[model samples]
Target: MLATTPKPPYYAVIFTSIRTSYDKEYIETAKKMEHLASLQEGYLGHESAREEVGITVSYWKDLESIKHWKSQSDHLLAQQKGRDKWYAAFKTRICLVERDYGFEREEQT
Candidate 1:
């Protein structure tokens, strides 16, 4: 995952993976992680997708939250499983999102 820190009021964690061929269990595990991640503090938002590669971008309030998420037992186990069975390779890139500029195209007008 290639990521750049925008400036520094927020944080972004990018998780990218090249996955091995899978069966039905993949969906079950992914859903479980998504649910678990939502319960974490400082978690702002996330986006993810996979084609030839899988990528998930999780937004956080600060570096502390990022650290916490990384160390969570379940997450750690998933990391191990990914390395051992699920992923061909993976990378995580963390960046401080200091500034952001975007607009809502949908207006209330």
Candidate 2:
């Protein structure tokens, strides 16, 4: 499902990663982080996809919100775990979404 974001000029944290063979704890941590993010201030919404590579994009109200999320203690731990156990490699990018448009087909009766 697409994330329901507010109007443009928001920040998006794009986390792209290649995972390791370790799967047990990683899935739990990922879900935990998503839940924790939902409880944070300035958190707009998030969407994620996984295949050979995984990508998670989280929307925020501002750069400050992004920074705060990074500094969050639980989030910090999750990051460390990602480095040590989950991800073989990863890149994070923050972008300002100045404009966005999309189309969803209506269900036919």
Among these predicted structures, which one has the highest TM-score?
2
What candidate 1 gets wrong by more than 4 Å, as runs, is: 1-8, 107-109
Candidate 1 lDDT over residue span 23-104, tens digit each: 4466778888877887898777788888988989988888898899889898888777777888888999999776777544
Top lDDT model: 2
Q: What does candidate 2's lDDT look like per residue over 1-109, in tens digits?
A: 9999999989999999999998877888888999999998999999999999999999999999999999999999999988888889999999999999999999999
Question: Candidate 1, after superposition: displacement of residue 24 in Å?
Answer: 5.2
Estimate the TM-score for candidate 2: 0.97
Error of 1 at 93 (Å): 0.3
Cα lDDT for residue 91, candidate 2: 100
* Candidate 2 residue pairs that clash: none
- Candidate 1 to truth, TM: 0.83
Looking at candidate 1, what is the lDDT of residue 75? 83
